[model samples]
Target: MNEQEKLLNARDRFIDSMAKNMSLYGITHSVGRLYGLLYFNEKPMTLDEMKDELGMSKTSMSTAVRQLQELNMVEKVWKKGERKDLYQAADDWYDSFTALFTTSWRTGISLNMSTINRSLKELHNLRDNPETPDEVRASVKLDIEKYQYALDYYDWLNRFVDSLESKEIFNYIPKKE
Candidate 1:
């Protein structure tokens, strides 16, 4: 193959790989493919342009773009004198990773911590109640301990998320130059 053809082939392979691998983040392969296209494009593309290039429906293109935006993977851009909205992929992998992971992790941690707090509250009450059976009180105390440990872990996870968002994690694990 000619040099141009070889380069195109490599691009196709990487784009396809991106489409498949993005499933790890729960994105549909089609949407992942759309991200890959935007990442490889030289300039921001309009929704109509993306629809034509990907042979996707206008609705699908819109949904894909919205999903990428939510994940901080793609952003809309303003083009001078342009009527349609333009979007381009976020090029900084570190920022993208930080946004994606911190957002999801914080959400999950918040939910779990809330649940653990409620459960611990009830367990503590049960354990402290004089009327409670000795056996049940022991069980409640053990459950409280378990929940407290989980809460501690979630607290640590929150700190980890903070480090990632603040780029302080790089102090311990430096990025490649």
Candidate 2:
């Protein structure tokens, strides 16, 4: 194959690799592929352009663009007097990265706290039961202490994240006394 053809092949494989990696994180492969194409292209593309370039169905392209939009990974640009919405990757890819990070962390924190609370409540009930054996109650009390420690750790993590200034985090350097 000619040098140009080899380069194009390599580029396509890289884009596909990105899609696969994104899919591993539970994002749709098509959305990642679309983002790859937009990130590489010099100019914003309309849906038809993207479909033609990716050789995917127009419906797939439409859905991928919408999904990327929802993820804050892409934006619609207006062309003067043009009715079709032109799609472009976000100006700073970090915007997309931060959005994904914050959303996932928020959900994880909530779910973890909920589960810990439920476990602690059940353990508390087990310990408080009048007919419970002494040994069983002691075991339940130990489990409750472990759960409380876990909840305390999670709360510390939540506070740390909440105190961060998202935009400035990357450039921040700690002051030395």
Candidate 3:
């Protein structure tokens, strides 16, 4: 194959791979297409341009752009004297991933903690009830303690992530025993 043909094949492969990977994360096909186009483009693209290039409906392009913005994977730009908005992928791809992962982790931890706390409260009420079985109350108390410990561990993890120094965090490697 000629050099130009080889390059085109490589580009096609890259976009296909991106679409597959993004699909695993629950991104729609149109969203994946938008990402592939933006990632491969030489410059930031406006919504209309993205719609035209991807041959996607305006609504699909808007949803994809909104999702990308929420994940902090894309940034909006405005040229001087222009009313149209442009979007470009984040400069630091790893930072974008980190932001998404951190946000998701924290949200999950928060939800789990809330559930644990509610369970503990219910256990306390059961213990206070005269009709409750002693063995059942004892078992629930143990479970509550376990849940509390887990909640504490999650809190520590959040602190650790927040306290991370950028250089150290990225370069961190666990020591061998």
Candidate 4:
């Protein structure tokens, strides 16, 4: 194959791999494909341009762009003479992965911690009640210990997420020289 053909083939392979792997992060393959397309584009693209290039409906393009925006994966940019909205993919892969990873992990940790805290509170009450059976109190104590351990783990995870956001994790696990 010619050099241009080989380059196109490599680009397509990258895009295909990106589309497939993005499903692990709860994103649709089509949306990941759109992100790959925008990542390789030299200039910001409009909804119409994306639709024409991807052969996707304008509505689908719009939805995909919105999803990307929520994830901080792409951003809308302005062209001084252009009226239509243009969007550029986040070009920094490290920052992009850090944002995505930290945000999702923090959210999950917060939710699980909240539920665990509530359950711990109720379990504590149950254990303290005089009318409760001894066997039941013993079970509640075990549960309380388990929940406390989970809370500690979540707290550690939150700190890890903080390090990721601050880029302090690189201090301990430096990138390739």
Task: State the lDDT of candidate 4 residue by residue for 50-130, as single tens digits.
Answer: 999999999999999998888779999999999999999997776777777777787789899999999998998999899
What TM-score does candidate 1 get on C-alpha atoms?
0.83
Which candidate gets the maximum TM-score versus the true structure?
A: 4
lDDT of 3 by residue, 1-177 (tens): 999899878987888887776666666666766777787777888999998988888888888999988877788977887678899887766666666556666777788888988987898898788899989888877887898898899898777656442424645753234
lDDT of each: 0.89, 0.80, 0.77, 0.90
lDDT of 4: 0.90
How big is the RMSD of model 2?
A: 3.8
Indicate whether candidate 3 or candidate 4 has the larger TM-score.
4
lDDT, candidate 3, at 64: 90
What's the TM for model 3? 0.75
For candidate 4, the TM-score is 0.85
Report the Cα RMSD per candidate.
2.6, 3.8, 4.4, 2.2
lDDT of 1 by residue, 1-177 (tens): 999999889988998898787776667889988988899899999999999999999999999999889888999999889999999999887887677777778888999999999998888888888999999998998898899899999999999999998999999999987
Model 2: per-residue lDDT, tens digit, 3-33? 9899889888998998887775567787788
TM-scores for all candidates: the values are 0.83, 0.80, 0.75, 0.85
Candidate with better lDDT, 1 vs 3: 1
Query: Given candidate 3, what's the lDDT at residue 108?
Result: 72
Q: Is candidate 1 or candidate 4 better by TM-score?
A: 4
Looking at model 2, which ten-residue stretch has the lowest summed lDDT? Answer: 168-177
